[model samples]
Target chain A: MSNDNEKDWPLWEVFIQSKRGLDHKHVGSLHAADAGMAIENARDVYTRRGEGNSIWVVKAEHVHASNPDDAESFYDPADDKVYRHPTFYTMPEGAKYI
Target chain B: MELNEALFQFCLRRGDDTHVLSHRLGEWCGHGPVLEEDMALTNRALDLLGQARNYLQYAGQVEGKGRSEDDLAYLRNERGYVNCKLVEQPNGDYAHTIAKCFLFDAWHLPFLKAQLDSKDEQLAAIAGKAVKEATYHLRHSSEWMVRFGDGTEESHQRAQQALHDLWTFTGELFETDEVYTTLQQAGIVPDLGPIKEAFDRTVNEVLAEATLKRPEDEFMASGGRKGQHTEHLGHMLGEMQFLQRAHPGAQW
Candidate 1:
């Protein structure tokens, strides 16, 4: 059964965490009537093979995005910020988690 | 029947229910109300079919008939099969399908829990795997029941009507026979008293949350366990077994 009231409910971007330490990585997108339905669909679609320990679904529309049109100018400034990279500081020889 | 033979029949009935219901759900594969719902329904169908394969194979082994799972499944006639009439009922609508599933899963979850104590270790092990799937199915169906029951004028009407139509079929789930008795007495199966009790509570809670009234206990259809089924099953089996019947021992 479907809640067909919404002709096109909305698109949801599915994210799945394969294990506890892993991030909820974006897997794919599906259309669902609500958050509950979205999460349910995501579980069936992306995690059927025990591929995920956790799931996170966000409305595709709700996610903020940066304009690719401004790619030349917007990200050019960060390209020179070498200190922002952790590689700028040498890790201790004994570092593990780092 | 001897206890082992009784248990074999019992397993066939249980597996039959899953097989028939899975086919009904499979009918909704491409025709679901929505794309996601379509996938979801087929996903459930696949799950039920997986369980059916395991249970039916065990039943075959127990019968000592040398029949493979496919033989028992595809070769069985109407009288040879034993599944509840509720499952054989048509997928009238989304609401009807959900109601059917809600009722079945309510009983299945508890039934599997009780099966965890069965003297039959293999049955208990299968139940261990099945109960988890049943839990998720219950959650999904219960959510839809509430959503449809409380959603809108149209949804409420459809959900209520579906419940009323399907209520009569729910009684057969608790039906008992000599085989069931033998199995239970032998501890190969659990008493269904607690299973029925749990089902009642679940149906009531979901109906209450959905603002839907439970239909009064009036007339309940029975006899499926005796190989007496509604007209639906014959038609369903015709479609389901056509390929195998036409091409005996055909391999995919």
Candidate 2:
């Protein structure tokens, strides 16, 4: 599709980390033609006051997110896997705090 | 010579330029073409006004006459101010405003970067913090300039016309005077020639990217730094100083 029309700019998801040692959390989505333009649009929209140390922009179409209806099936499986829990095992003697 | 004497004048000039331009930009607060751009312009304007407050407060202290930033800002006469002419022009349209900002911010970023090495500690500190802000201002303004200039035929015509209308006022930014010469000799200010060269390169690059030609052989407007200004400044000062002039020593 030609993205020259006013409504043609594809939506891009914006993820921003406000500082170092922080995870990039999804802030919002804005429309842009490319990743570079998406980053600029995100900066203009989200980070007005030196707020973010890093930014990640992904085309909204490319995000492989599970539907809400599958939340139980996708997430509940890990909850019952108690062997994956670290609390089940005791620490070795004189082991550093974990 | 006393440092405060020169510093007071320098800070007022800096403060006035930012204050006037910020107030002008604030007019676009609710009226930007898009919501993102609306926020962008206002955010930049707020940043400029914040910088103005810092510099003006410093100017008050350097004057050492018990005046506040508001007094320095709102009590000054037209001849006593020293802001450049480009900032006081009316915000005719979005393209015009963006073009004016691109022109000024292009000069300001390098100017502030050089001032980081100033002999005056306070000026250097102010310039150091301001350069970071100025870098973003240049980026935002240049992005709009390029977009509008290359977007559509109507946008292209408007942006190019704005550039031509504002180009005359740009020469005053590089026009030097005795204060600049004295400061430069004393290592307190950067040489204008090099700053002008860098400004030219950056502006030309952006214009080329926008597919717009730079205006040529125009009669350059001058004398803003020396207190001469266009008629627009009178109207601006009238609005800006009305409260202070009406209620002398009024506090909020």
Candidate 3:
């Protein structure tokens, strides 16, 4: 009997860009009965003041993640890769606006 | 009256409509059945309040008055307010509030669209900006109307009852009053007669989509634009004006 109530809508993660030049940032999650409702809910929750120019809502279950144990192998290798760093490049004598 | 006077009156009407409706909608903050809906109602309220501020400030400037937007909002008596009676009604429940919004938002969105090209530059500018906000309001309310109307048996029954109950107040939105008539003569505002046609089309389409019937054969309520109001307005004003009434001119 409670299954009808317990089978709540899926949770969706909302991402919004506050303005035209801004990057989309994750705001919050909302439970919606469907994808369309999720998008509408995201708008209501995130864009009340003309804050967002764009929105993206994805079901939380669809997100893929790497194991924390693989962090060293996955991300540590890039940390010491100084050749991949742009810091080695010397600035010109006078870069006015840089 | 001069053009500025007409524009001032026009903006006051517009501002009062938004401000009162926003205050009414704001009552739903945190009280909505679901969290998402709670946020939706509050968000719409904020949008309307913001628009009201803009319009009221413009109205003050046009009137060449020293009063700020808050003064116009808080100091005015009930008779001075020009909002349609539909907005001043109580938010009885979720379905009731949604039904009220569905009716008003349907009219407001299209009406604002017509104002985008108003002869008055300021009015046109504000309308151009507000049209987008009103579009979302209409969409959000319309969607809920469909969902609730076609949802569970109890939800459907409640939603239909809400529509019928609030149907009388809807006519006030389209009533062409002296202010509107004078403004139309000056080309400062759109003729609401045409706007009503569009409003009816949109409302009927939404009602059809929701499988709800159009309410029939009831005498429509009027007089909000003419300063007469329902008994509910007094209670609403008493609460809304408490802060200002208690501490006159006091501000943080």
Candidate 4:
């Protein structure tokens, strides 16, 4: 579409859940006229080979994320925190929840 | 016509409707107004082609003269096909195409559902699978129609115009002649009277929601079921059949 005539549709992010009890993983993105069409487009584009059991779509502008410029300050502090890891815990034999 | 011949003819009409409509939808391969819409339309086109293949394959078995599905699809001349005249009409604009598909999809859903009760096992099986697809096709096209009908001033005008222009072609879909009458008598096909009524109810509901008037029945186009079609179908067949005709039996 020309800039003067046709306005571009908004971008939407797509997420897909392959199985029950699993989180919907982000697959890719597509452009759609609305949220309804976003889901339809996501299904047609990403799930044609039966790659998903459920789908979630959100307008790209709605998503909030950490600033990439502050990545070093925001992430470097956690890297030295070995306590965040569960490596010190010993597995009880056949402990299902652990 | 004999019952067996009538059934064969009936199936051919159903198959031809899918074939021609599929071809029209295929014209949107890369020309869609949007990328997602392009895929949506072409996927529906592919669905129609799959249904056409099933119908034509069964039609060939009925013919029993060793004609394969490919032969029936690619070999027949224009007049031999019995698709409804509505499907062969051009995909004029986006709204026009959506209006065309919305009309057909709305009618096809019930028609295919009725076919699931066919006495013929093969036809029943085909319809059983096809009805599910028809449901989805109806949803997709009808939703688009609603938006186009009520969306912007320009979109609303375009949609109304498309419906007005295409309304004449809608009548032929439910036209029952000797072929259908014979098939219905033999329990091979359902009575289209109730189906037409059902189609009318659904169409009226959707059109009302869209805030568009059902165009008054003006001049109605007919005769594709009798192997007559608009000038477009001939050109469509020539292009669709060229490769198959030129390279007979050639495959990778």
Candidate 5:
């Protein structure tokens, strides 16, 4: 019954960790009935080519993001702040651990 | 039977099981209920095909007749195949397909795990790799079984019907003959007793969780291991082997 229709399930955001000591990166999204099925769907859809050793899936609905409508006022102030960038300072020669 | 012949038969049985089931699952290429399911089923089919090639290649080598994997796979006729009948059964509905896959995966996982301890190095290695694939396969199928059997009324009825219809064919999975007995005696293969126990435990656990009743094992069918099969195998082979049979040495 759950698989009777694609719309019956909710979309899940998939994150895959390619190897050890790596952060899980958002790959794509797929539909599944629950977290278990979402993890499995993520594995099938994302890890088929040995792309990842670990997977994390969150329901798309649970992933909150800033509204684009507030982008200009909420983010544009940082555009002209050149001092925030480390490029303004010159690095010493042979400074390997910068 | 001679030792070489028994070993060949043993490999062929396992090979044919995966080969035929892969073909059956492949038939769902563009036909799954959803896009995700389509890919998932095809993925399982590919896994089975990989295992099939390994077993079949080993079978050819064991035969020592210079037959390659492709030759044994593409040239085999209906009677030449030794897969159990359960793998050859038609994929009826979604419920039927899940039932077929679940039943087979339950037996397949443990069987391959036992093969990991095989006295023969080749078989042991193959089993080592195959056990991993079969583990996920069993999980997927068993999850689907729970979904179908515990889902809506319609799904419950369909799953029940499919299980009842397919139960009889399961008996042959544990049945043994001289070929298997010989291999078992030589320590090349494990005894069926423990494998059957594992199969039963998994089946009972899954069925209970799914809220589905176990069908009575009665009038069990046999002979697929001996190359005797239902009419289905012939029709399936006609389509599966058509290209190979029609044009000799055809290649991409």
Candidate 6:
């Protein structure tokens, strides 16, 4: 439950990196008065269960996301490009991580 | 007091400090000004609760009794608790809660840090783990203190009022008697002098950044170390221990 008074605070997008070498995946969003608070709130909200070792919080308004309405034009063309698949490459022996 | 008895009392004091404060923070579970804050407060509560369990478990061992952690926590009467009075003060408002937490955390972090070198291995281990949690707890509370003190007209007034109201309780954090003397003489605990200095430094720094004045200790409250507590502890314990009292040895 959120109070009407808290709505005035800016919204921030939270990202959590589960390990040292991992990327910080988008976890969720929360309201904070500033960047420092956003990071702290992200730690509290997203990492309470040892979910992450590091966190990044950016203002939600600052993210430039592709328009959802343009999804067909922006992404659908890639579906038919089977030649772009890397699966056709022959695998080298003992290529562990790959 | 004998060494064992002094150690038992010392452990109980540390345990009770975290336990009572955890219960108080739990009160904010559903009532924080915002949902993120609600979760944040409860997270701190759980961290303190975990530390309380460890301390109480060690305390039970030091007492040479067969009592478990639950027994030490729920079986004790109000006077048996040795937490400082600051932990039991009512959460008046957001500002008041922040003030109480800021003052306690400022003292607590240094106290745990000094404990890291305790001759008692178990205590040193507990303090080692607790220091990490207390560090973040201080950061969280101090951040809120700055925000509340410097944010707006209303917040500034309330923040200042909270500092005044909670100032008296701050003195109890450094009050020492036989329990401390016994432990310090044994090298089981560090001197309170340096801890007090660190507390003063933290408070002064945070308050300066917040643009708030520090309150003077005109009339200091004490006696929590001797199992003396305000009327509030009884009321709080009444609710916290009701289940254990009503059903002895009850378990899931």
Query: Comparing 1 and 2 by DockQ, which wins?
Result: 1
Query: How far in Å is the alpha carbon of B74 misplaced in model 1?
Result: 0.3
**DockQ by candidate, in order:** 0.59, 0.34, 0.48, 0.66, 0.47, 0.75
lDDT of 2 by residue, B1-252 (tens): 455576677788899899989989988888876666787788889889999998999999988899998888888788877999999999998899999999999999989999999998888998978898899899988888888888999999999999999999998888776666667778888888779988999999999999988998479998777788898888888987888888887778
Which candidate do you rate higher for DockQ, 4 or 6?
6
Candidate 4 residue spans exceeding 4 A from truth: A4-6, A81-83, A86-98
The lDDT values for all models are: 0.91, 0.86, 0.86, 0.89, 0.93, 0.93
Q: Write the per-residue lDDT of candidate 6 for residues B1-252, one digit (tens) a residue.
A: 798899999889989999999999999999998888999999999999999999999998888779899999999998889889999988889999999999999999999999999999999999999999999999999998999888889999999999999999999888888888999999999999999999999999999999999997799999888788889999999999999999988899
Instruction: Give TM per candidate.
Output: 0.93, 0.87, 0.87, 0.93, 0.95, 0.96
Per-residue lDDT tens digits of candidate 4, residues A1-98? 44543677888999999988788999999998898988888877898788998999999999999999999998989999999999998988997634
Which is the better candidate, 1 or 5, if ranked by DockQ?
1
Positional deviation of residue B195's Cα in model 5 after best superposition, in angstroms = 0.7
Give the poorly placed runs of model 6, Cα more than 4 Å off: A1-7, A91-98
The positional error of residue B218 in candidate 6, measured at the CA in angstroms, is 0.8
For DockQ, the strongest prediction is 6
Worst 10 residues of 2 chain A by lDDT: A1-10
Give model 3's DockQ, 2 decimals: 0.48
Stretches of candidate 2 off by over 4 Å are A1-8, A71-84, A89-98, B1-4, B242-252
Enumerate residue pairs that collide in model 4: none
Model 3, B1-252: lDDT tens per residue?
566676787788889889888999999887777788788889889889999999999988888879889889888888888778888989997889989988988899888999888888888898888899899998988898898888888888889999889999987777775667788888888888788888889888988998888898489998887778888887888899899999999889
Model 6 residue A59 CA deviation in Å: 1.0
Report the lDDT tens digits of candidate 5 across residue range A4-87: 554488889999999888789999999888999889888887889999999999999999999999999999999999899899
Model 1 scores a C-alpha lDDT of: 0.91
